[model samples]
Target: MARSLRYFSPRRECPFITIDLGSIPESLFESELFGYEKGAFTDARKAKAGRMEVASGGTLFWMK
Candidate 1:
């Protein structure tokens, strides 16, 4: 399914940001989707852009 989507029109432009929901842990969902500021968490050493940010100006596909 992801393969076909990658070859399609809008998805073709941003093929690297595809997300498989099943692989992500429920606890990490927020951080992954919205990203975190520097020092936002104990393990966070620097600010990081979330999936949404990375997918900006591109496509973001959520797979079940």
Candidate 2:
């Protein structure tokens, strides 16, 4: 199921991002999805964009 989705190409000019929900830890979900601003945490040294931000004007696919 995931293989086909991974290979599916959209007829658009946006990027595609996929997330394997089963492989990700529950604790990291929030930060992974919404991201955080630089200096928002002790370990955050540089500004970073989350999945949602990266997926802007693109496609975000999730497989369980």
| Top-lDDT structure, candidate number | 1
TM-score of 2: 0.73
Clashing pairs in 1: none
Local accuracy of candidate 1 as per-residue lDDT tens digits, 1-64: 7567567766576636878899999989999999999888899999888999998877788898
lDDT of 1 at 22: 96
1-64 per-residue lDDT for model 2 (tens digits): 6446545656245667788898889987888888888898889898778888888877788888
Q: Each candidate's root-mean-square deviation in Å?
A: 2.0, 2.9
RMSD of 1: 2.0
In model 1, state the lDDT of residue 25: 99
Q: By TM-score, who's the top model here?
A: 1
Candidate 2 local Cα displacement, residue 47, angstroms: 1.7
Those runs of model 2 whose alpha carbons end farther than 4 Å from true positions after fitting are 1-11
Question: Candidate 1, after superposition: displacement of residue 43 in Å?
Answer: 0.4
Q: In lDDT terms, how accurate is model 2?
A: 0.77
